[model samples]
Target: MADALITLEAVSKRFGTVEAVRASSFSIADGEFFTMLGPSGCGKTTTLRMIAGFELPSGGRILLRGEDVTEVPPNRRPVNMVFQHYALFPHMSVLDNVAFGLKLKKVPKQERRRRALEMLEVVALDGLEQRKPQQLSGGQQQRVALARALINNPAALLLDEPLGALDVKLRRALQLELKRVQSETGTTFVYVTHDQEEALAMSDRIAVMNHGVVDQIGTPREIYEHPTTPFVADFVGSLNALEVVIDEVVGDSVVCRFGEVGRVVAPAPHGASSGSTWRIAVRPERVTIGTEQVAFDGGSRLSGTLQQVVYLGMLTQYHVDTPAGRVVSHRMNDEAGLSLETGAEVHVGWAADHTSVLGPASS
Candidate 1:
């Protein structure tokens, strides 16, 4: 991590008796789209503010481009933050708003207009330079704010839920737009948001935070496919859990007894002990339900009664109550396919490799 653009070494933040951030540590590589993702009150915003120099760390250090900036003032850090609320000046045109930062740094009048116009063009808002903030749409105003922040060419850009105000469609649109802008500029972006889908869509990597502590940090695929902790597995997506009692641990595999349903064999999770209780989780899409028996290695099949059916346009979600436990299965909707009514008997199953052994529930 010698080339890390930003590094937080055991950074923590507190307000009086309440601790907002724990001793969180991570590094962002140069030109990477990194995200701090979690629900509200998870200290993601607090960590972002600490990096922006708006909130001083209670302990540990903050480094930007190899320089220690733990005590640096907001105006002095080599980073800029874009807030959810677009604090644009109503009296000033888009061009003027973008140029305001350069002006404060004593940029010349003619040069200000030139640089401002150029940055506006970078944001695809060149022709709208003369429009005031009041006359622009919400997304347009956000672009103006972004252009203003990027005019200084900071080492990194810190965004605090910048798209939280836009409508769903608009937000989705801008997610791609922002990714394009970030790629085009080649600036490291440390984006903060609570939206897991947004993080999966735009981030090179994500740090999932919970209760002022970072639970896991990894690529979207890794976070989804192999969540290390129960908190991460449950929070990142919808998962069905099955409690099992381990009969024995054979090498890296464990033999789990599923009561009268059946016995299952799966790879033991790292650090799992022999003859201990564990939870196995599978996604709804991974759970298959049918009256027909399927053949597959390391797959667990159980009998269940279909309890509920929810019809979505693309897929049908079936909830089943099994001897092992309740499970859900998702099947694609097809024009000529048959109908599986509720209260019917069905067999539920999934590949053991698709199963993940979750950490203790209390973790």
Candidate 2:
């Protein structure tokens, strides 16, 4: 954070009686693609607005490149915003939409046109500069919107779910395109999105927010593999949560018992003690499902009846019913275990290191 570009210090926002965002604090390094990810009404959008100077914080300060800009207006700040909808001028061509900002600044018409064309090329829409917004595809129009926002050379670009409107395939394509643009321009991007896949695919770092609280912030792998909270573990990916009672605490690990026939040795959470109930979670991909029992060194095992097999193009999921409730395991379409039929007895196993202790079980 020595070269922090955007910093939020105890920033919170309240809409009259409703607290939209709690005291949230984080730093975005220069040229980093930082994402605020959560479900709707989680205060992610409100937090983005506060950073963009559209909504002033009810508490704390926002700094851009070490300068306090909490009270700065949106237009005066060296930042630009792109919304879910591409707010393009219906009457103007794509080129004109891009050059609109430069025109407002009263730059020479020739210079503005030259820069607009260059920006179009950067977004891979150079040949369609003369087309109207309505004439282009959803993905193309989004690129135009991106080109328009980045054309101004803002120190940081704030995108509020810019890809939310596109179709699934198109959205997936643009996720990579957006990251490419951000990297090529070397502009710090403050992106907001509710899609877990989108956030994981494009972010250098992510802040997982829930009910106005910042639950965890980390890289995609860190957040997915080592979630510190139940919300993050359940929200970031498909998880199998099992409630268990601690039987013993052995050094750095805890032996927990679940249901009538399941026992697991998982890494102990802070302050873990015997007789305390806790929840442990494992990702679906980490669990292995098989008809025969397999010995796993330092791992946990469960016996269950295969309930269902879900085939999702490149991957498949096996849902098994065990004494501890239902557990799921994921495997690529080509992997073994796909031949197991539903209603057959199966063994589910995962390495102990892949399990995460999610504090305590909720009452």
Candidate 3:
């Protein structure tokens, strides 16, 4: 925790009557790839802008490396940003664009050129220094933008949806490139994006934000596997949420008494109370859609009518309607799944370990 390079204590941002970011508290360690991930209007970009000195928090202090930098100007802060649009000057060549920051700082002509070329080479954009932004491809232009930002050697790099403009294949490629850049330089990166896949693929730690508040912050595995809230469980991946009332608490496990679905057993989340309304969340991959009932006791099972079947090449998804209403389950395209068909009666069951008891479904 002492290695936290950026610390936000009780940070809040408001625009008139609308609250953009709540009193959020979190920290980013030195050299860590931290991401602020959420949907549009979730205040993820707002948080990044605050840290980059583009916007000041309405309240709370912002600290960098144990120093209060709340009042620091954007240029004075030890940080640089790569904008979503690349923000490069079309008139300038790649070399001049990369060296623009150094020129602003009054770096010597020779040294600035040397550093700019070194950065261009680092980003694999060598030999294209003479080309203007309009002359370069989208990916090439992005690399130039990165080189320009990194040439300054800031303590941390802030990226605001840097890959939003690229195509799918190009975005995937740049995700790898960005990860490689972060690893090679070992510079702390604070990236903001609404893409969950990008965050899962690139970030060392992700802060899932919603309604201007940090919903959850953890490693990719932790965020994907042990989600603390239904929003997180549903947002991170495909989930089958079933509403059930809790019947009894047996040690660490809870027996949920579903209306027409019958008894189900699953691990209880912390602070779950007996006889309370809870939801059983199971991933699509964990659900098994079988024509007949599988002999698995001490587990949860539901019988439903298979309504539709979607062929996804590697896997087939079956939509079923049970007493708990409509639910979707995933199955591989193997022998066990070859006979799956719509309008067939099937039994969907999951092991206790695979089902998570998320208390109370959101309205």
Error of 2 at 292 (Å): 2.3
Tell me the TM-score of model 1.
Answer: 0.93
Candidate 1 residue lDDT tens string, 1-363 = 877999999999989998889999999999999999999999999999999998889999999887899998998888999999989999999999999999999999999999999998889898999999999999999999999999999999999999999999999999998999999999999999999899999999999999999999999988888787788888888888877777777787777765664565667877667667788788888877787654556677777788999999999899999766788988888734447889998877778777888864342
- For model 3, the stretches where C-alpha displacement exceeds 4 angstroms are 257-263, 270-274, 295-298, 334-337, 361-363
Candidate lDDT scores, in order, read 0.88, 0.92, 0.87
Task: Please give, for residues 76-97, the per-residue lDDT of candidate 3 as tens digits.
Answer: 8999999999989998989999
Ranking by lDDT: 2, 1, 3
Tens digit of per-residue lDDT, candidate 2, span 1-363: 789999999999999999999999999999999999999999999999999998989999999989999999999899999999989999999999999999999999999999999999999998998999999999999999999999999999999999988899999999999999999999999999999999999999999999998999999999999999989998998999988888988889888665565667799888889999899999999998887774688678888899899989998899999776789999888885358888999988889899998888888
What global local distance difference test value does model 2 have?
0.92
Regions more than 4 Å wrong, model 1: 259-265, 271-274, 335-338, 361-363
Question: How close is every model to the real structure, measured as TM-score?
Answer: 0.93, 0.95, 0.92
Give the number of the best model, judged by lDDT.
Answer: 2
